[model samples]
Target: MQAQDDFLKRIEKLNEIGIALSSEKDTNRLLETILLGAKELTNADAGTLYSATEDGQLKFEIIRTDSLGIAMGGTTGVPINFPTLPLYKNDQPNLQMIAAYAAIKGETVNVPDAYEAEGFDFSGTRAFDQKTGYRSQSFLTVPLKNHENDLIGVLQLINAKNLGDNQIRAFTIEDQQLAESLASQAAIALTNQRLINDLKKLFEAFIQAIANAIDDKSPYTGGHCHRVPVLAEMLADAASRSDYGELAAFKLTEEQMYELKIAAWLHDCGKVTTPTEVVDKATKLETIFDRVHLVDHRFEVLKRDAKIAMLEAKLAAMQGGDAEHAAQLEAEYNDKIAQLDDDREFIRTANIGGEFMSDEHQERVRAIAKHAYVNEQGEDAPFLSDDEVYNLNIARGTITKEEREIINHHVVATIKMLSAIPFPNHLKCVPEIAGNHHETLIGTGYPNGLTKDQMSVQARIMAIADVFEALTARDRPYKEGKTLSQALKILGFMKKDQHVDADLFQVFIDDKVFLRYAEEYLDPKQIDDVDPAKIPGYDVGA
Candidate 1:
């Protein structure tokens, strides 16, 4: 009855060991658990676990000896310096070493005593015993096979102890069975964990590859795709540490941080569907090539018409012997030529994009549009088309309303694409966080136009990061990158307009997140010293 109770107790311990092995995520800790658990079940004094390498060798993964108080590898951080036991020698299976031979046979080898054991080499064991003044005996070598029946590793235990007396003895039949059971459970757990980790790495790489592809689609905005994540993480860390404000009550766990990172990387993923022509529209009239050159050709035509009229008058005057009338015609022709030249120059200046277009310049573009010239069909037409006039007079940046709408649809695309993905529980909020990067606190932002009350803190964090990165980014086509002061000033106005989270903007200033980002990504010229007091909507020293 005692013997039966002992068997049931060992079986219970084996079940518990299996549970612990499956629960462990860290590879090193899982390995240590398998080795130590096997040792405990068999009452072994020392043991070592060897993983099979692709090169046909048994690599030492963990080594522990309770009597000598020695532990190496695994969670101990002490590296195992011992050489691997080669499974093959000269293309022949190495059956000399007991552990290697057991792996080759795919079965457990139980030795009643290693000192008197034969058929397997124990010279290394004897040498280790002599150096440590310890007797080495009672070897039980078990091959760990996964569910596929492939040998994954070997579990070798040494020096089992007799419970009735403290003397070392051979591993029992029951001991061998328990060790083998634990080895099988451990192999399955290990294989599952490895698969999980590999899939995770593949998923992250795919996400980044999409981000990079979007960047590559528009060279002007490529850096924007990379920089926003850096700023997002920077602001996120600041928010995590805040003690007071909207974000003070909020905190992110490691899993949440990873989720945020994924969101940041994929925030603009919808850009993949955006037309490269619209995204890279560098000038007011750019499409494939700048349409301003077409307008430039019309100015040349006007000049040619003026000169022809002057030559005609000269010919008629000479035919009628009217030199005085011909001279007057020459003076008028010079004035008309000068005025056309000035008008062309004015239109050319208006064609280039700027942060703001004054009414005076816009009116000049309208005036230039009215000037007439002959078309290829020999019909009179305006020097600048109405459409050309409209594009040239865009009051803000380069993109016109129609093109702006096209650009804005990328956020919509991002939302649609990400919402369809069934993320795991930890990443369930990825679509929301990424989709909301373009939203505003004032409820005027695009797609859904979500307000501050509707937005999460994580979404707000991405907003500031997105805005600041765009402001200081030099890779854009329409305007030069802003100085640090200029970017912050715009952010301050955004805060005043309730377009950004007030507290997060304040945190952005107080923590100098902008400076941290500027130091790394901004051009030296764009890194000018900023006076926080002068920044619009920001309260310095508050």
Candidate 2:
């Protein structure tokens, strides 16, 4: 009755260990647990856990020796310095070693003592015993195979001690059976962990590929997709570490951080559907080509016409007043050419989409569009087309009202695209976090116009990241990237206008997250002096 009770108690302990193995999430911790649990169950003095490598090698992953007080690899943080043992030497299996032989044959090898064991090379074991001044004996080597019957690795134990008298003894048949059962459970748990890790890698790769595609679609946005995630993470991590304000109590688990990273990478995925011409537009009159060139051609035509008319008038004047009238005709022609050149320069300047197109500028564009010039067919046509005038009159940036709407549609598309996919429970908020990057804090932004109250802190963090990257990015040809002070001042104004989250912005400044990112990604020229006292909407006293 006493023997049966001990056996039943060991079986219950094995079940508890199995439950612990299944719940472990970290690979190193899980491996450590498996080896430690095995050692505890068998009362082994020392053990080594060897994992099979893809290159036909047995790599020592975990090592434990109780009497020597030595622990290496796994969660110990001390690397296993020993070289891996090859599973195959030359063209055949390396069956001389006990661990390799057990892995190859899928059988448990029970040796009463290393000194008395046969059919195996114990030279390395003997050398180790000599160096450590410890006697090596009673080996139990078991092969670990997964549910698919594929050999995962080998578990080797040395010097099993009898529980009654603490005497070194060979493992019993019952000990072998229990070890085999625990090895089987450990194999399944390790396999499941590897599968989960591989799936996570695959998912991350898929999203990154999409981001690269979006970036590759437009020359101006070449590195925007890659850089935003870095900044987003920097800011989010700083916010987590903040010790004051709304973010003081904010925290994120490892899983939450991963979800935020995924959202940042896929935030602009909707840009894939946006037209490359619009995204790449550097001038207001740009489409398939810059229509400003067409306007330039019209100016050249007007100059040529003026020269022709002047020569004709000179011919008539030469007959009546000889040299004087002919010279005056030439002067008039030169004056007309000068006026045409000035108007052409003005129109060229307006086409750049820089300054605010005031009423005076609009009037100038309309007046230029109304001037008649002779076409190739000898018919009168406006010097500037109505479409060209309308495009040149865009208030700011290369994007017009219509093209701006088209660009804004990308955020809506992002929401729709992300919503269509069924994300796992951990990542269910990705769509919301990514989709609300463009949303303002005051309900003035596009798409759903979600305010700060309606959005998550992650979405707000993304908004700041997107805006900051845009302000400082040198890739866009339409405008020069802002200096550090200029960008921060603009961001400050944005906070004042309630366009962005104030708490995160404060965290951004206090933590100096912008400086950390700028040193890595910004040009030296873009880095300039920043004064906190002068920064708008920022409380320097705080």
Candidate 3:
């Protein structure tokens, strides 16, 4: 009855360990759990877990020696200094080493005593025992085989201890059975975990590839796709670590953090649909190419026409012997040239869009458009096309209203694209988080126009990151990257305008996420000192 009860209890523990293994998500923790669970069930004093490597070797993954209190790898941060044991040597399977032999043959090798064991090299184990003044005995080497019958790793436990007397002994047949069962469960768990991780990595790579395609599509946004994720992760991390106020209770699980990061990476994936010409427009009169050059040529034509008329009038005056009229004609021609030069300079300045285009500037553009020039077909036409005047008169930045609309449409397209993807449960919020970066606390933002109350904190964190990256990015086409203080001030104003989450912004400032990211990605020259107290919409006390 006593023996039966002991076996039943061990069976129960085995079931518990199986459940734990299957449920475990993190690879490192899962490995540790498998090794530790196997050791506990078998009552082993020391053990090592070796994962199969692509280079046909058994790599040390986790090592624990209970009696000697030695531990390395698996979140201990102490690296395994031991070299990998080759599974193949001399163009064949390495059967001399017991662990390598187990992995290669896909069989369990239970040696009651290593010193007394035959048919395998125990020199390395003997040396380890000699160096540490420890006795190595009773090895239960189990091969972790996946569903496909392939050996994924080897689990070897050393020095099994008697549960009653605490004396080292050979592993019981029950112990071997339990370890094999656990190894089977662990293999399944590990294989599933690796598959999940590989899929995730492939998915992330696909997302980044899409982002790169978009970034490469527009030369102006060269690194925006890459940098935003770094910034978004930083701010979200800062928000997660905040210990007070609205975000005091806010936190991100490892999965949630990964979701946010993936969201940030795919945030602009919709920009693929955006026209490269509009996205790359650096000057107001830019399209497939800058039309400012065309305008420049037209001004030259006007000047040449003026010179021709002046020379004709002078010749006629000279032939009629009107010397004074000829002299006045020369003065008028010089003044006309001066006026034309001024107009051309104004138009050139207008083409390079910056700041606000005031009413006066718009009027001047319209008036200049009325000037006549010979068209390409040798017919007279307006010096500036009406469309060119409209583009040149853009109130701010380079793109006009229609082009701006086209640009804004990208966020909508991004949402559409991301929503179409069937992300897993943990990642279902990816579309919301990625697409809502353009949204505001108020309803003024684009696409869905989701207000702060309707959006997740992750999305709000994204807004702060996106805006801040834009402000600090040195690679934008419209403007120079702002100084640290200038960026903070602008972000502060955004906070005041209800564009960003005030709580996250305060955390962003208080935690100095900006400084952390700036040190890494910002231009060294743009890294000016920031005085947080003067930030426009920030609450220093809060």
Candidate number achieving the greatest TM-score relative to the actual structure: 2
Model 1 segments more than 4 A misplaced: 1-7, 55-57, 67-70, 79-85, 97-99, 111-138, 161-168, 315-339, 531-542
User: On a 0 to 100 scale, what is the lDDT of residue 408 in model 1?
Assistant: 92
Please give, for residues 1-542, the per-residue lDDT of candidate 1 as tens digits: 99999889999999999999989988999999999999999999999999999899999999999989999999999999999999999999999899999999998999989888888888998899899988888999999888888878999999999877858988888999899899889889888887888999999999989989999998899877788889999998988888646677978888888898999999999999888889989888888999988988888988998899899989999899999999999999999989988988877777778889999999988887888778999998787878898999999889999999999999999999999999999999999999998889877998898999888899999999999989888888878899998899899998999989998898898889999999999889999988888988777766
TM-score-wise, the better of 2 and 3 is 2
Would you give me the overall lDDT of model 2? 0.90
lDDT of 2 by residue, 21-103 (tens): 99999988988888888777788888989999888889999999999999999988999999999888997988989999999
Candidate 1, residue 174: how far the Cα is off, in Å: 2.7
Model 1 residue 537 CA deviation (Å) reads: 4.4
Taking the tens digit of each residue's C-alpha lDDT, what string does model 3 give over 196-249? Answer: 889988988898899899888877888898999998899888888897578989
Cα lDDT listed for each candidate: 0.90, 0.90, 0.91
Task: Report clash pairs, candidate 1.
Answer: none
Give the distance in Å from residue 327's predicted Cα in candidate 3 to where it truly belongs. 1.7
Error of 2 at 464 (Å): 0.4
* Clashing residue pairs found in predicted model 2: none
Structural similarity to truth (TM-score) of each candidate: 0.89, 0.97, 0.97
lDDT of 1 at 356: 94
- Quick one: ranking by TM-score, best first? 2, 3, 1
